[model samples]
Target: MSEMLEVKEQETLSETVPVFGYELIREVLLPDILGEETPKILYWAGKNLARKYPLKSASEIITFFKQAGWGDLRVVKESKNEQILELSSEMIVNRMKTNGKTTFQLEAGFLAQQYEGQKQVITEAFEHPKKRSAKVQFTIKWDMKDFA
Candidate 1:
């Protein structure tokens, strides 16, 4: 809803998300634009999301949901400290995966389908009765353990 894009990454938690003017566009936004092929698109979206926000820890990513108007994002798995994000939205899920059909619908739908099996999809959504948005729930997982 806002034109100004405020993006930053934090290994350590920093920057608080403001309420309103934010929409859950990750899952819905990426897929429609890049269809048939989902890997490249998902990768870019994940990287971009990681870069845009200072999601240092798994919990922080969850908190981003409430701030971004998305649902309750959570982490259900941990591979030696590496957490995975699961995003879902009933409203957005039922929508088509075609590009440019509807900005929010397309974006939310794309994000949901693209991350399926490829990574941990942690996000959910609810159709706004009056507003032109939905509540998406998802988690963002990162590789915390590195091998040498």
Candidate 2:
């Protein structure tokens, strides 16, 4: 009985929302409500969300991105003060094809805050969407001199 319950819990945790529903809210409704400021607002919103769901390691952040249906996140490069992460998915490809101006500011901000929490330093992230490649690259940089 306990084994079955555990399986059920795992299944529930892994359940995902349909892509159409997600796109409707994220692309349509949000833009309609927030207008030109949508991208900026989403970036800050992602930071707040990171604060609410803090994770200890890069692996945990990667897992969280998958669980949240954002995309498959992987570290492309890492240095002392900077890290490059790439996110790719079929959904991301679709979004890029459908909307040329699609922004990944939310994901960028999430990464920035997560790294800030991990390194205890002030961090910022920039999103570069590769429309041709159908991927988004995030460059996260931390100021070692500025402690958070």
Among all candidates shown, the one with the greatest TM-score? 2
Q: Native-vs-model 1 lDDT?
A: 0.38
Give the per-residue lDDT of model 1 (tens digit) for 100-129.
Answer: 243333233333333332344443221122
Residue-wise C-alpha lDDT for candidate 2, range 1-148, written one tens digit per residue: 1344345448868576799999888888898999999999999998998887787889888977886789999999999899999999999999998877688888988999999999999999999998889999999999899999
List CA RMSD, all candidates.
Answer: 10.5, 4.3
The clash count for each model shown is 33, 0
Best by lDDT: 2
Q: What 10-residue stretch in candidate 1 is worst by lDDT?
A: 123-132
TM-score quality measure for candidate 1: 0.38
